[model samples]
Target: MIEYHSLREASPEQTIAWMEVLAENLRPSDLDEIAATSDMDPLLSLTTSVMLSDMAWVITSNDIPVAVFGCAPAGPAGSGLVWMMGTPLMDERRTAISIARSTVPYLRQMHQRYACLWNHIDARNEKSMKWLRWSGFRLLEAVPDYGREGRLFFIFARYDPDV
Candidate 1:
């Protein structure tokens, strides 16, 4: 069974287990992006991201974590910077489709108090860029020299002026 749990609710043992899986199975694009932006190892990166997020969730399938995702407040009030990282299990066809469909609702919940939700995606991650567009985020511009390694990245955002 698939379940969603608040990141806060994860036990230390569970966190370690998830970290191990993610360390071994994180997508290449995710690994590249993290390496470009920080010196922290995958485990530390995952832990730090979850800690900094204002609202984050863990998606588990039969008790194994498949993904962790959330958003943190960004500069300028009512704006949020969102992110997601997942293990290879998330790429299973059915799981992928379900996760894609669920993203909008999760973003809606996360953006309830924010006017805009935005983030940067590695330019090489075409799958994620397509998914973001499908979820209604507009791709703004590409940064040719983004992050520590100067890899290309594209800024994407979803705006709700009424919020």
Candidate 2:
């Protein structure tokens, strides 16, 4: 079974361990964008989520982390940026799918306050793009020279106009 937990439910050390795993396993195509987005330190990104996210969840299966996702306010009136880190889905397909399924409801709940929640996906990360589309986000635009290292990225979003 997949379980969701608050950051307080797991020690900071445990979360950092997950972040380390995510960092070590990032695909070469994703590495530069992730570093640019997260300020070059994956641990800092997770730690920031723990501190600033209005909504966050760590998804685990059989006591092992499958993924962690968080949403934090971004300017532009009730908009937020959504972020996620996970173990390689290819290695844990079932667990990753379970986590992906759970993320939709969590995201819907965030829609209560966030008019739009978006993620910047590396243009070369086709796997992530596929998953994001399946999870209900629209591919809004392709941004050229979007990152610190001049990589391209796509902006994907789920928007609630009523917010």
Q: Global lDDT of each model?
A: 0.83, 0.74
Clashes of each: 0, 0
Q: Against the true structure, what is each candidate's TM-score?
A: 0.91, 0.83
Worst 10 residues of 1 by lDDT: 14-23
lDDT of 1: 0.83
Put down candidate 2 lDDT per residue, 1-163, tens digits, no spaces.
Answer: 8888876577878767766665666445455556755565665655676578877777777766656778989868889988776656433677657766777888888899898999788887777777788888899999888877677888899888988
lDDT of residue 18 for candidate 1: 74
Candidate 2 to truth, TM: 0.83
- Return the clash pairs for model 1, or none: none
**Model 2, residue 89: displacement in angstroms?**
4.6
lDDT of 2 at 36: 58
Model 2 misses residue 8 by how many Å? 5.3
Off by over 4 Å in 2: 8-30, 36-39, 89-91
